[model samples]
Target: MAWTRLLPVADLPVGMARTVRVGLDDVLVCRLDDQRVHVLEDVCSHDDAPLGDQEIEGGCVTCPRHGARFDIESGAVRRSPAPVGIATYPARIQDSWVEADLED
Candidate 1:
């Protein structure tokens, strides 16, 4: 797997999310806390709504359109209306930058 640098770790505030384009994919990168970060697809599974602007609470992102909530870390379905979970990517911090494996 190849790790692609998205942005600086310091640029991403804790408990917030940002969208980055890697190749042809629009990835949503969320910083859950000081030490944890999650990368997932930017679209909601059920209605294909964009999740980039959704609010994150309790480690889950609630879809603004239909009220579907999904866990940021594991891409699990936390609340219905989503029906299924989205795709998650492996993320890490290296050289003070946030990186994610886009090969998967």
Candidate 2:
């Protein structure tokens, strides 16, 4: 598997996510519950809006444009208008840094 270093773990706060560029795509990397990190496509499935600019609550991030909600853990579109699912990247914390695998 190919792993790309995204950011230092200190840069990501628990319960929050940040946008990182992987190749030509922007990904939302989330540091969740002090356990695992989740990476989802930054653009919302609805209207192609950016999910990173929206507020994060519980485990979901809402789409700022159309109010579509997405579960960060699974990249599931929990709300409508975003009927399609998002692409997810495997993520982990290694050596005090956050790394994501975009090989898939």
lDDT of 1 by residue, 1-104 (tens): 78889989898888888888877879998988777888899999999988875457989988878889899998999999898899999999888888898775
Candidate 1: segments with Cα more than 4 A from true spot: none
TM-score result, candidate 2: 0.91
In model 2, what is the error at residue 36, expressed in angstroms? 1.7
Angstrom error at residue 99, model 1: 0.5
User: Which number leads on TM-score?
Assistant: 1
Q: Which pairs clash in model 1?
A: none
Model 1 poorest ten-residue lDDT run:
49-58
Model 2: CA > 4 A from native: 53-55
**Backbone clashes in model 2, listed as residue pairs:** none
Candidate 2 achieves a global lDDT of 0.83
Query: For residues 1-104, what per-residue lDDT tens digits would candidate 2 score against the true structure?
Result: 88889999898888788888777978898888667888888998778987774346878888878888888888988888898888888888999889888886
